[model samples]
Target chain A: MNTALCMLAAANPVGHVTDKPINGQWYVSNVTVMLVLSGIATLWLLIPAAKRITTGKSGSIDDLRTRGVLANMVESVCLYLRDEVFRPVLGDETDRYVPVLWSFFWFILISNLLGLVPILDITAALGLNDFHGTPVGIGGTATQSIWVTGTLAVIAFVFINGTAIIKDPIGFLKHLTAGAPVFMWPIMVPVELIGMIVKPVALALRLFANMTGGHIIVATLLGFVVSLSTALGGVSGHGLAIVPLIGTIVIYFLEIMVAFIQAYIFTFLTCLFLGQLVVHAHDDHEHDESHGGEHAAAH
Target chain B: MQAMRFHLALVYTALLAGPAAAAEGANPFVGTIYQAIAAAVVFVTVMVVLKKAAWGKILQGLQDRENRIKHDLDQAEASAKQAEKTLAEYQKLLANAQEEARSMMESCRADAKKVSAELKDQAQTEIDQARQRATEEIQWAKENAVNEVHAQAAELATNVAGKILRRQINAQDQQQFVNEALAELGKGLN
Candidate 1:
């Protein structure tokens, strides 16, 4: 087999890796599509939002009370980010970073949904046939790719520390060696670096593993039916044949649910990291406002 | 050094992964993906136009409608004030006319009574004058009639006396004596 065919054959059951090349460079196939779709969806969502905020014209109480397609969509997305993602870990710091976090939440959500669509799954299904040509709109779970999630995580990582550094240039370095002796600096510095780098890596892998794992399980189950049917001359060969079909269908639905959950998880962690970076536990008044004076009294 | 290590690790991973999956040829999705991109651009352009044109007019129309309603209310209020003033003036005029009519009626009643008294007095004077004139004429008529009666009575007596005398005398003697006596009597009376 040619190199391209060989590469596609080894791409696993999910269409994570494909033979499609852009400018002679082989990009991670699904990641490119996810990023594109996410950008477009973000712009589409933000237009009316920008208009609403800039104009200060709002829908009436009737509009808020009822659900039209556009209103419902905006409300649902905003509510999910606020209640589920931002409120939990961020707590007091939630407001400042809520917008960016919400954007990430929605973007990740749409990309995950796009990955599960049947048309995108065509290339993965007809693996051998895909050697002839790349299927239209072919992609798997975007969350599965390390580079995609890692890039997003790295951006969060930089902004978090960057802001903290900018806020208190002197105090920022002091926190790294906070309570340790002079001798521990050499060991502590490397440890802190690992700690910093590991956070984003963890964020990336957690999302990627969860998303990729679900798709792989569904694909493998479907692949079993295909192999069995070919061996036995037909799909309904043995009584055991019904087992694979039912299992595939069940796993397929489970995979879809997992997609949403993973997207939410990724966004929630991002809020947590941002909160840690920006929130200063030192502000007595702010602490009192947020935690009802408990943490302030303790301090 | 740490940042360098991170970049190196990323590059190493890329190099090791080798043209991912190393299979498949000719991707079919590439042909028409650009169309969606083009459509997105058009959609954004349309949004800009709508925001500028349609939204502006709608807001302006709402404000204009508010102003027009306010103007109409003001006009209605002015007209109502004018009507109230006219009504009050009419009421006052009616009152004045009623007073004038009342005065005129009172005067007419007084004039009628005075004129009736004057007519009664005039009629009384005319009746008195007529009665006096009638009484005077009756007295004068009575006096003239008595005088005429007396004159007739005298004429009768004289005639009778002459007849008696003629009867008593003889026929012949009487004729001669009568002539002589009448001549003597006529001369004496003349």
Candidate 2:
């Protein structure tokens, strides 16, 4: 790997740790394919679910009353995310951002889950790891890549601050001083600024690190099983391998749970950040209204 | 404090996760710009596609369902109110009907009572008239019968007197004889 080069492919366990050429194009790699696949999976899953949700043009009572399991399950999760997870924070702005938030939720969730499928290993085992003398992969967790998560974080950051700044530019700038006196700008501004930058950076790192760490843990346990088998190289070795295999199984379960959790965490944090910024518009409006009421009362 | 801990854990994991890249002498914190761009591209594409395809329709459905339910509830409430009003009106009408029936029955009863009393009086008058007529007829007949008997007796007495004497009697004599005979008969009855 060129240590300094920034490319579309990143390292993984079973496939190319570096971007490889395929049909003379170096951009194609496992995470790329997985991202595309995740994108497709997201669309494939949600399109039908969307149909089930939409009912019809008239949206009749009986149609509204019933739904398929897929629609119901998808709807329950979406509702939870929309109403319960972020509604308090996002307030009136929840709808405006729900599409983006849901996209992130389902896409990231699917990507994270795809990583656990061992498709990369299966391809590598089937000797499809190298195709036409170029390395490629069929599956891996797209969200595990820092580029992917950081990009998502960057998008969230943009939306959060951009909307705030757009809606209330002066307030957005004023918030940089951490609500302290003008004299405190020397300290509070920088501190608040740092806090702002750190938030999204933390979101990206949290997801990337969690995903990377879980896979690593599972791999390490499996590595132990491999070493155990290799050291004895027989039935005894296979007998010795059971311990790490069990550990791998346990870690794999945890990884599965973590995949969902990390996706939820990313979405939840995005909403919280959005709420933190956008909800101020409502507060400002309320403040103005209160002031107006007070002036009227005085009159 | 919780956010700080979350960031700390992330930092700790990043350190733990980056050994292979570290050995490759790459900064793990930084990602490739191209991949970063790809990530943004892919995510934005998803957001756009989903926004177009699913989110709008799904949210609209939810809203429509809510509105439908609200409308159904309102319609149901209005219908219930109307039913209640109709029931109350029917009950009121029924009460009026029953009152009218009761009043009519009372009127009929009173009229029947009046007619019965009138019939009783008329029947009594007719019965009294018939009894009076019957009593007058019976008295007249009895008077006639008595007259007949007196006349016959007078004639017979007159004849007998004449026969005893073996002589003819005149009208004036006969009258005297009839009066004597009647007086003798009256004395004998006493």
Give per-residue CA lDDT, model 1, range A1-299, as digits (tens). 25423433433354333223333334434456555665566556655543332222253333223134663455556655765657665665565556556556666676677767754557546652334354444555455555566656666676667877887776567545543588998887677667667767777677666666666666555544543443343323344346777997998788778777777766766665555545556344442353332223222
TM-score of each: 0.50, 0.65
Off by over 4 Å in 1: A1-30, A45-70, A122-137, A181-183, A235-239, A282-299, B1-190
* Docking quality tier of model 1: incorrect
**Top candidate (DockQ):** 2
Candidates' C-alpha lDDT: 0.55, 0.73
Candidate achieving the largest lDDT: 2
TM-score of 1: 0.50
TM-score of chain B of 1: 0.49
Task: Supply candidate 2's per-residue lDDT for A20.
Answer: 29
Candidate 1 displacement at residue A286 in angstroms: 16
